[model samples]
Target: MQQPVRIAPSILSADFANLGAEVRAVDAAGADYIHIDVMDGHFVPNLTIGPMVVQALRPHSAKVFDVHLMISPVDNFVTAFAKAGADIITVHPEAGAHTHRTLQLIRSLGKKAGVALNPATPVSVLDYIMDDVDMILVMSVNPGFGGQSFINSQKDKIRAIRQRIDAVTAGTSRVIDLEVDGGINAEMAPVAISAGADVLVAGTATFQGGPEAYADNIRRLRGPLV
Candidate 1:
């Protein structure tokens, strides 16, 4: 049987002042993973959380920390995120020249390695590194900020990457997760799912009305999958 789709709620849209409480509330509401977007102003015109925030929030929930690094010079922060309790660390290949090394570093720290591809980026970049990664993040919108509209053209890209991942790990024990993020709400979710995305990341949709809304929002985004 195929694995059930996973919902990873992004904390970028959560209340920062009450992050620990927010995380706990989401976890209680059945979030599969906690998606954390770490941005550097130089990389995507925004600056957000760092290792300290992650470390402090680590004790609040048992859900996986899906740390997305939208920072250039990505290598310097790999260890910090890993040490901060990120279960899976995803990096944009465009942010650093040595993506292979970055993947290796993440794995060295005993964490799942992931690569995020922007809407304009070709899926070909993942060819050689397919076997090296644990997940492939398909950005449905540009990376810089949250709440952007979904780039509908990415449906084909998600399908192509899923095929590549399956082909590369055909004979191995490896299983790669195909994740879709940005502007993901109840409506756009099925688009990605139909195109073979297994993990959906939602920010504004997930935390919009506070913790009580999380379960309903997640249920809606999940559609019949619940």
Candidate 2:
């Protein structure tokens, strides 16, 4: 059976003072996963939360902790984040020298391994590692910051990755999830979903409004059920 699309609210856009409450609110608001963007100043141009923050929010979240690591030398920190409670750990393909090893490390640590492709990165980078990962994160906007406009060009990228995943895992029950991050809102989400995305990562779109609005926003983004 085809699974329903999942909405992951990025905590980067949440109020830090009451992060726990914000996380719980979004979970209650119907977020399938709590998306955390972990950025190191060197990797992306900004610095954001680290494993400690994820550990703190872990107790408040009953949903999956989808952690996206936008930091350089990601290999050194995979275990730390996993121990801190990341259910799904994603690392950018461009962040390290050994991408496959990093994905394996995340898996070895007992978390779902994911690979992310930057806006400018091609879909072919995932070819060799496709079978090993649980999800592929396509950045529709540049990383580091939230609320940026969606790069509509990524629609084709998402479809291409989805096709590749489908081709490789044809006879197996194992399925690779196609996830789109950046600039996802109620209006843009349907476009991504129609293009074959199984997971939608929304930051500003969820936090721009209050909790109730955030929950309503997720429903609106999902659109009418087929």
**What are the per-residue Cα lDDT tens digits for candidate 1 across 34-124?**
9999999998988899999999999999889999999999999999999999999999998899889999999999999999999888988
Off by over 4 Å in 1: none
Q: Cα lDDT of all candidates, in order?
A: 0.90, 0.89
194-217 per-residue lDDT for model 2 (tens digits):
888989999888887777688777
- The alpha-carbon lDDT assigned to residue 148 of candidate 1 equals 91
RMSD of each: 1.1, 1.1
Cα RMSD, model 1: 1.1
Considering summed lDDT, which 10 consecutive residues are worst modelled in model 1? Answer: 165-174
Candidate 1 local distance difference test against the native: 0.90
